[model samples]
Target: MYRLKQMNTLRNQIFLGFMLVMLIVLGCVGFFTYGQVSVLLRNNAEKHIQQTAVQAAGKLDVLLRQVDTFTAQVATSATIQRLMAQEAEGEKTTFAERQSMLQEIRKHEAYTTGIRSLELYTTDYRMLFPLTDVSLNSRVPQEWINEADAGMGRLVWLGLDPRNPDVVIAIRNVRLIDHSFSYAGYLMVQVEKNYFEFSVEGESADNGSGEMMGLFDGAGKLVTSDFPEGADVEGMLHSGAKTIELNGSTYMPIQKRSEATGWRIIILTPVNYAAEGISVLRTVVVVSVIIGGGLFLVMTFILSTMITRPILNLIKVMRGAKLGTLKPISVPSSAMEINELNNTYNQMVDSLNELIEVVYQKEIVQSRTELKALQAQINPHFLFNTLEAFYWALEEKGEEELAEIVVAMSGLFRYVIAKTDGDEWVTVGDELDHAERYLKIMDMRMVDRLSWSIEADEECRGAPVPKLLVQPLVENAILHGVEQRLGRGTVLLRATPSDRPGYTRIEVTDNGPGMDDEKLLALRCSLEKGLNSRSEGGNGVGLANVQKRLMLYVPGGEGLTVHSSEGQGTTVSFEIPNAHKGEVES
Candidate 1:
């Protein structure tokens, strides 16, 4: 039952439904936003890598062109040519010629820092001048000479040297100035690896960025890399793919090949680093969603409460109206619709109260009028004078029992009819006296078959009750109970101070044949049905009449309670306020 009620509340329904929609909306927006940000970051990273590769490749090209230009100047020099001719002719060069050739080459090397050493070789593959470095032997290989001669005086990039892998070597063929253009010798220039590193490092430093750069030869051999130990340079260069994954990290490789040097500049940028902002963005999005959802829930609770509070209050008032309580809504709501509804309910309550007031006044007037008409049926003065004559005549003949019967009958009729000009209220003591007079007549009629007792607490004796209230029950007791039974019957009437403050309890019990469940139910139903309903023939009319009159006197009262079974007697009871003077007047 608790679960059922929880499921049905308007607040829960609205709050839950709104939260569900919020979650879906936030989830979709966050998901798509995070995806787009990740893509944008990756694309920007790739573009940066491409830019770095381009700048590095351009610098390498410029450096290699500078080396080629320097080599060309040396090859065209008169001193270097005359020396190469001396070496070609198998002549022992003079010290001055040797000093002049060495001075000229050393002079060019001093202008640029990239050149480590320069060697001039003859057509027979013999170096004319060699440096003291062990890697610079006074010999040239057949393949190196053939490769240089094939360039026809143009520069040829030989990549890493076999003797010293750390040095890059380039060669140019020296030729005669005449149209014959005969080969004089070859000029081999050795460049330190630091020159390439300088260009790449300069570009990276300008951008305040750090990434792995590898220079690869046309043959796909790795020349130099910034961090060669940490990466797979050869594998990445030969993979033929734009991206590489190594050590559990994905990297995007941007490659630019230098046309002059036939060298590839490969820059590897880790994809995760480029997308680092995505992680922060994801955290922000989640927190925003949670905070937004929490605020929405609070607002939903407050709004739903505002909407449902007045309706619940109206329901409570309506439930009270079922038990004859009518009250207007005293407080208004912030919402116009709910306020209007409350106003309408209050208007309905006013209209219903007015209708009930009209009906109740009419009923009171009709009840009094009918009561007066019934009282008029017997001429009070004539009946009273006749009973007086009979009472005196019987007493004169020394018949005391007959005289007493006449006196009781005259008192009963006087008590009932005497209040026709006044309100229908009487003290409990007076109603009990009237009931005793009626019971005495009933005892004379039933003789040995009837017996009764009338009792009242001292505090209840002066309590007000409607006129003729107790007598009807006494009459009903004698007629339906004592008269119907063959054996002797007993009837008891009791009035006591009620447990409730300023109220009294009255009971009428009779012992006779009693009633079966069906008959008892019908009798109780008749009492509940009120005066308009026809009662079953067995004492129902009198019992219903007494119940109806009690309710009329005490509006909204539970008129009577009947307790009965097959062989047990029946007891009927009612409670009345001790003070009913204002109630009767109104």
Candidate 2:
């Protein structure tokens, strides 16, 4: 209150104080909001990742069980037992015996691949191996075998078959014959790791790196792993237990799997994917900060405007004077205070002019000014010169069609030189005609090496667009493209009306040497940017400028676009909100 009294006479100081307090308050709120949102985001993401990983693990569990079930079914099959007996009861057969038995097992494959090799070992402690002797190096998984020795019997998961990586996951079954309860030779089917990886990865895009979907033996021996080469799987994840870890680096993982195989199917996803809702909260807070900041400015500006309406008007005039907006004393409005400022601005301009005149000679200045003036006239004069030549050709060859062409040419020149009379928009027909004439001029200049076709719905011909809408692009297509190549080029102009959202479209296509997407993009950026750069190739590349002008005059006027590919043709199109005949004037 005391400071307010001290700065009472300083209105801007008071307003600044208000704005500063608002900024600090708004900033504090925004900061706290960001924190809360970020925490929520993290929590939600972690939770979601955990859930998904669990589900994926469950699916993988089913796959492992299916493979196990199939492997058991194949081994117990009467045919496989008979094949094993054929080799077992015979005199020591050659390597062919095991291969033949293995082939017999393969013949009865389920959805899962059958065992690559079958083993036959007798209770007498003597062994019968397949042609490939698949049982040569096959050892019962120590944990399961130990349990089997300890009478911990049933079907159990063996970690993997090291001899063949294909059999990364396998099962061991101990059955007693004649009440002896002896260990039987194990039958292992190779499961393709990549096939499962591709299947799961296809569904869950980001599950690659952190997700470990592989099987380990019941004894917890490392068997098959999808973890990147050196990731310590045995220690990180163990059978019968699942854990979630998100260090907030790249991804957060939610793990799910079957304890049966010690086989893990983990869905490791980016924490963000899990925490999408939390991100939304953060977004809301950020949006709120922006909205609050905006509201603060709005309130402050409104308060200031109400309190200092008269003074702000004075300041506007004062600033305008310095900016030369009041040069030669031009403030046409009739407010008393405004008039007074206008007078003061005129006096300042007069004072400046008197001072400049005292310092420079007229001739040196006039020559420099004239050079710039002439340079400005060069492009327009050259363009007009081309138009004039085209007009004469039309008069000589197409006299009946010359009137509309002449009128469009006149309108084009008039819009350029005398811009005030040009409305914000003109009819589509006029714009199309202007494009035709521009293309015609190019064709005449290039010995008619190009052909053009104009297509538009009759109703859309009256759709309004900013003046000189299609002229520059059509000119560029011919000057830079059609004429650049010697072959006869086709320029197709099409207008389409859409009823779905009630929009009209204009498309210009060219069959000249179409540019690559990069060059086309560059041209588009140049068109949208409207930077007044002369064409580097001397082909009058001013498509950017015309599109920019269209956007300026027509609200929501995103009405120019180009599509092209090398060796293919090019098409440029734009959409307008409305197109009604008789609704627009040229």
Candidate 3:
């Protein structure tokens, strides 16, 4: 019982809730921060390794291409080609001829650095540099010779020498620059391993990071490495893994292939180096969470006491409110929100009795007003009959024109004021009739100063539209466009099947002076505002009101458009979607 009572205390509950929320938040933040930081560091490390490998490979390719160019220069020299042609023609070369060829080979040795040797061989089986050593000739592999022959004059990389394993080899077959284009001889260039190793080492030393790189041949054999000896290079190169475990340490491997030499350059980066930042961040996060949790618990205790003490005082004061005593009670607290809350409660208490009395008075007045409104109601049919009686009385007195005006007025009133059961939709023909009556009344009232015409498609006459849809446009035309002009004006009402399917176009055009750009712009702005505000129609509906009503009544309706130029006629048009309705009696 005592534990339950303690748990029910408001200050204890608030402190426990805040502590629980803080713990969950810290745990989630730490988890996500650890995962995200680790991934980012790993990616950055791998990207660095990849860039290093590509740079090294690019340098090596430049050196190898230099050697290739030198070989091409010697193979295509005019003296060497002529001598090779002589040898191919079964002519025995004199010592002077062989010496000329030896000079030609020696001239190219200085073309590029790190060149171990350059040898040229013909069908006669002679080494140009060593003159009499068959061992130099014997060292040339038959497979290299065949591959060179198949090259048809283009250079091909033969990779590291298998016998010595310390030399890089390249060869190309030469062709005579003649009409026959006959095969000449083979030119082989041997590059020292130090040529490529020097570049890789220089790049590694410049980086200053403890990362190692190795160059592998096309067959995945390690040709040279900046890695320490016996570093399991073969397993690292062939395992095809992104990360490797070497000596119980993690390393990320990035490999790039050289387009020039078809060799693979592999770089290995220490994972520990990349994760050092992650370790520091982890320690900071742990310490911050512990310190923040302790401070949050202390603050939660202080805040709960400040909050619950005010609430308890307010509760004690509100106990009098339930007994129908309408009196203000004040609760003082240091918190701004608590003080504001107390002020609001006191104001509500002071206004409670006044509000009850005011509500009672408003109900009595509302009942009396409703009774008067009911008593003032009249049948719509009586007004229609009275107008008809006035029309006939004017006709009997030989005032035919006045009688016609009276009939049109009666129609205008009936259509505007009468309810069509609960349905707001009417046929286009009925709406046109309403517009015609309104136009007739306006034209008669203007003393022959106003005239109107309506041209409607027979098919469009039966389409459904909101009642009074067309009458307002005609009224607006006569009042604003025609009456505002100096002389007679004409209003043309056109109804036709719209180009858009399942729609009808209605246009009201006036021949009075049109609006200038400024007035037209203001009028358009008014219509747009009306559409947004959804202003409903009144007895004196203007263009904006008509547009709002059209938008409300017609499905998929876009309201109205006005086109006008100063001193020219104005045209207002709108499209209404066709709606299915019951047939109307003629």
Candidate 4:
């Protein structure tokens, strides 16, 4: 199995595919060439052996015909016939006459060099001359005698001589050339085994090493063979010319039959003799393939690297960009497509950087402008209303309480206007103090009709809260809820730790003529909908501005909430996150 992380690279895949194809092509060519060369070598060897056998068979046939012609000449001689006729009549013959006849017969004995010995026998199986202790009738096998008698003056092969197993002989019935064609006796010509050997003497001289040659008679009997030890003679005789393996050696057998002699000639040549050149060719092909494969691998490696190097470089740059390093990439490459891709990436990065800078500057300027506008709106309305009330108290009431109201009003303005460096949050204590100051001024204006109280938990006093967030709600409660009533009303402000962690709850309540469900619903909807200072109502921009500030500064959307009932009190509350923990002294 192949893995993506291992050989899944495009370069590796292409290299592997190329190598596979080369191997297949080389393997196919090598196999085909080897097979063809083997076949050619084998066929050449077969043809050579077959031609040699044909030549040997032709020579053997000529030798046998010469022997037969010599035998016929001896059989038709008049001198031998007169002697045989005289012997058949049982006539006494003188020693001198017998010696002359013997001399005449000896003249024909040297007719052929292939004949080892020649003998004549009478019809009664008696040798006429050149007598030996062995009788012709007793020495000859019955089968040979039967074949000689059946020949009726024709030459006949008698196979191997019974008296001398290594000798082969031809026999014929000798007859007188008379009107009756009377049989005189039998003439036998015996030849040594070397006579047959001379027939195939130079025929197998060119045969290669580990070659075996054999001759078999018509009945499939082994007449002679030059096969080495461990040769399977019986197996060879049973089978035709084909390849065989024996004793760990491979052989190709060639067999040919002679039409003249009814003899089979077989040759077994080792296969390796013909395969020697093929082995050398195989070695050359293998070496060439290996060297070519090595060169191909090296070239492929270089080419693949050339293709993938630029891609890897681009990937490295992309990784840097992923880590927030938006910088231009300048990878140089020979390929036009890669160069164009890098240029496009650089352009995109430049555009993005410019866009980020423009957006950041615009946001900073807008935030400052909005904060300044809010400040301007709060300063004029709050200071003017408080100063007018203070002036009225000084003119109409005594200066005893007016001085206190002026003092509180001065402290409230000082707290609001005193800017802290880079600090957007104020403590809950400071916010409650600002609200108390505003209530004090309003108390003086309402006199007996307005009563107000401010309460805050010590734990919540130090809670950091948005500036001017609570004071506006208290002013609205007094002016709208309590001041509108016919009877004296009470205004209350409270700040305490809320049930939610990391937050403080601030509520402003007024006991006066509370609104109906419709008015309360409308106010609640306006708070939830996120009021802005541009909004106009009985509460003017104060309530909306506080809600907007809370929404912007707080973590969640818990800005402001209002609850009221007819003939009951009205309460407005909101929660501030991170406003419950500070440097508060217990």
Candidate 5:
């Protein structure tokens, strides 16, 4: 009896612990699952509603466009053109005469076939034609007629027609080629309101059951609904045209809009159908756990619980470790089985982290060495020799020649040393000054063989560029490319400021021997793949460096382009933003 009482106490403790855990876990899982599903459905439904509204609005805009196009065609017709031409010739039209003329035009097959009704109003904003008496009561408010006259080239909605009560679209326009030929009149087209209502009705709304669709305006007015026509719409109408709600009993209310007509379409479905599987998913999670608990304990027999518990811990630890998350693993141990498992895990984690740290340090050192090697490739030795030659010439010359040589040397050395200071982009003036220096050196070598021009819209001069960017191309042209040709060769640089609204453009053109088609193709390929060693070692090293530097600061690196043809000439151009334009700073 004493042993049985002790066992009962142990059993009660285990039962209480399991009940507390189940309550906490179920709360997290059930609420999380409900929240996620609700959010997804709500977001999807709103997007669909907005898209539907946009499509309907677009269709309405198209109808308006159609009205504008037809009005334009009639306004330019030979008959109407001739009538306007006569009015310019000083022929006065009488009321009876104007009435007869308008009636004749209205009866014509072309006008009668396409238009529901037509009106021609005067410059003073008075109705002048289509008079009921053919001689009286045709005059209308001058302001209304003048409003139509002002709307030429555009379709203006004019509410309902006073006579026939149809929707009217109107335009007021006068065309004149020379000084004298001008006419004032408004063209109006009456459209049936039912036509618009019927077009929207084409959308299929019913989705089985007793469900239906509806439409409302922004003012909470029920325009047309799939529900019974005369029924009160207070329950269905919403102030804003876009919201979804559950209707009384079995319905899922989904609302959308026709932006063109400013009409809303709401659809409803039975809620019973949607909720059917929700309960089942909830039950499966809770009931399956309750039923399997006894069988699970029996099969495990104290072994599976011990093993599974540690595996779960290992899973938690590795997930954090892989993400470089600094969290330690801690799990309970009932006996030596779990205690040994915990010790083994900690050793493996420590060893793995140490190896990773060692590899990372080695990579950092190697990367620094490669960067230094790239810098050493562009030597200052080439510029020094050219500057020495220029100094001797300047010592024996006048102020003009001395000024020329000084400018040349300054430009050359600026570009040579520019690579070390950190900024990628320099002012346009700085780049152009660098180009002038490069040109001066080549000018000495080629004497009268080469000529160049740099013309930029004064507004464009403040644009930016990669440092030393313009010099390498000038070198490539004078050395391996264009300046080597025998004929009189020329290079031109031009820049235009963007009143074009997005980017700045600079262009450089050369009239020396341009690359054949094959060379241009190879250049494009090499650039995309980061250039080959043989290519980069040549002019490619400088070009690739220019390319890399530009990509860091400018969005589109490949925007640098060459336009050239075999036996013709080449134009290499690039564009970057002008920081002074107030678009981007630095």
Candidate 6:
């Protein structure tokens, strides 16, 4: 009963853990995917709305241009110009002349199809075209007259007519075209407000629910709108192409500015309609998560039973063996492998006592042999040469200097061969110490020509880095920079905190003849491409190897960097993220 309870507890814990992890992963993925998809849909809707507005604006511009063209045609006619010139001469009014002038004005208005009304006014405010209407002779608005006169010949929008609020009027100044273009009169053209409505209706026909469009003048007053309740005129004027909330619903509004009339064409669509696909996706994700979770629970329960049954049976046999009963045992299982394992365990009880001593002795001998084999892999010639050099140094130099060199060499070898917890990393302080040892060996070789210094920040010493990360870079500096120089040179190694957080920067610099631009560019290209070996006449193989290792082991460390100019020194540097700081210290 206790074992059964333990098995159920284990199964429940494992199932819960797996479910928790799956829920987190799926939730994050669904959230970000939904956000991205929603953004894409909104952007596409905005583009479509903007395109529609642009087309509508284009049509409106064409219509306005046509109005201006027709007004110019009538204003510049010879029949109107001759009568205007005659009227300007202050001749006693002749009925035939007045009738001829009125006939000319009517003839021009008849040719223009969309014009609701055309009225010709002399500069003195005498109405010409609608001579029969007594109200037409009323005093003309001074604002319209002044704007028309100021236009100089161009058409000017006089806004909606106050007397007939449904009409939008444009006016042009009439002038005689002899030598001096004298102001003769003004010509006004009126268009019904419904004309603008018809112009934009074709684009809005296919738009779905909560879709609306509006034409607003430059001052943001609505001239026409398709929606019965209209839009938030103030909000539409202040906002650009974006999504907003209106009347307890989300809306996406797009505005296109027309250069001809200084008007704005706005199209508003509901956000729900625009993101229809996202709604379906959200539903699918919810349903899939629910179904997937249920199936995972059922599968987990079955697998747990299969696994724990064999394990429990093995435990029972182990308990029996522990109680000193060395007899054959049997436990039935549905799995063939588990049954075979049970049979093997029963057979092992009979011979375990007999083979214990033999197995212990064999393991002891095997461990020793393996240790000796690993030690044998070290090159004997290199060790002999190192010893011979140590002997020669002892004979030539005194004990103190030779002893220092020997110690540095020993330290370098120890660092190279040391193993730590199966990880290929060390502290920055240890790596620097290894680099210093290498430089010390080289210093003895060059004696007077090579001088070096290693400067590292106290805080950075404990930062974790890959083993032997800096030694190769220092070696490269000595080989490529110091060896190629004529006079004495200095190599500097510096470790500091990097610009990015949780990273350290290590730089190796040499005060020797530097590379030219072409060579520098080629070397950088090779390093960036992760070229393993240096090209012919190239001197960056060691640096490349170090860069590749750093990139492999360090998460955010971008390989190495080299900066050099002709006749100046070179600086090679790289960064290491300070991961596993505690591990390195321990």
Model 1 lDDT per residue over 179-205, tens place: 266777778888998777743556556
CA-lDDT, candidates in order: 0.78, 0.61, 0.79, 0.75, 0.58, 0.76
The reply for model 4, stretches above 4 Å from the true place, is 1-4, 83-101, 122-142, 145-154, 175-185, 199-210, 229-235, 239-250, 306-586
The number of the candidate with the highest TM-score is 3
TM-score between candidate 4 and the true structure: 0.47
Q: How much is 456 displaced in model 3, in angstroms? A: 6.1
Q: What is the clash count for each candidate, in the order shown?
A: 0, 9, 0, 0, 7, 0
Query: What is the alpha-carbon RMSD of candidate 5 to the true structure?
Result: 21.8
Off by over 4 Å in 5: 1-282, 289-407, 418-421, 479-481, 515-522, 525-537, 540-545, 556-558, 580-586
Tens digits of per-residue lDDT, candidate 3, 81-128, equal 888888788786677887787677777776578888777777544655
Model 3, poorest ten-residue lDDT window? 531-540
Prediction RMSDs, each to the true structure? 28.2, 19.3, 10.6, 31.1, 21.8, 10.6
Model 6 alpha-carbon miss at residue 345, Å: 18
1-586, model 6: which lDDT tens digit per residue? 9997865665577677777877777778777887888788767866776677778788888878888888888878887787777777775345676677666767776766668877777767676655553332264477667767788978887667767868887878788897288887777788888878734446545565456777877657677777548457556446563566667777777677878677777777777777767788788777777887787778877876766667766776568667665777787778888888888887797688668878999999999999997787576546646766885787676677777788788777767765557557778999899999888898999989999999999999998888877887888888878888998889999999999898899999998789999989988988888777542346444667877776677645578889998888899998887775333221
Judge candidate 6 at residue 305 and give its lDDT.
72
User: Which regions in candidate 2 have their CA more than 4 angstroms from the true location?
Assistant: 1-25, 28-48, 74-107, 123-125, 129-144, 147-153, 169-171, 176-199, 205-249, 271-284, 297-586
Estimated TM-score for each candidate: 0.46, 0.38, 0.55, 0.47, 0.38, 0.48
**Best-first order by TM-score:** 3, 6, 4, 1, 5, 2
Clash pairs of candidate 3?
none
- Candidate 4 positional error at 93, Å: 8.7
Residue 576, model 1: Cα distance from true site in angstroms: 89
lDDT for each residue of candidate 5 in 1-586, tens digit (9 for 90 to 100): 9986865643344554565565556656766776676566556644544454455556556655665566666655655555554554556566666656564555453532335655654443344456543211243344545555565434555444445544444544546445343555555566544434423334424332344555454444554445655644446444432323443454555655544344455555445433445566667666756655554445444554444556566566567666765444665666676667767667666776787898999899999999998777556656665666676667667556665766677667756664544455677777777787778767767788878887777767777776677766666555545555777788877777754565577777777777888988887666565553233236434555555555666754355577778777777677777663222224
lDDT of 6 at 182: 87
Query: What is the total number of backbone clashes in candidate 3?
Result: 0
Query: How far off is residue 554 in model 3, in Å?
Result: 5.6
Candidate 4 residue-wise lDDT, 1-586, digit = tens = 5575766877787677777887788778877887888788767766766776677667667777887888888778777777777777776445665566567766776666757777877787777654543556786877778878887888886666766868877888888876366887888888766676633435445553566667766656666677666677658546764578767788777677767556777766677875557778778778877887788778877887777778777787678668777888677878898898999989999999999999999999999999998788777568757776786778576785776787777777777676656456788988888888888888888889888888898988888887778888887887778877898999889988889887788999998789999988887777777655332245444777888777677645577878889989899899876533333222
Write one digit per residue (lDDT tens) for candidate 2, span 1-586: 9997865743566578778998788779878877777787677656655665666667666666676666566656665455444434454545655556555555655345433444445433234444333332345444544443443334455555655565654444434343353444444345554434422454455643333354444556545445566655566555433444434344444445566655555444544455556656767877887888788877887787566666566666567557544366465555676677678767887887877776667767888999998788777767777777777877778674564456566656755564444465677888887777666655555665788889888988877766666766676666556766778888888877954376778877787778887887787777766766455466564666656655655456564677888877777777776753323322
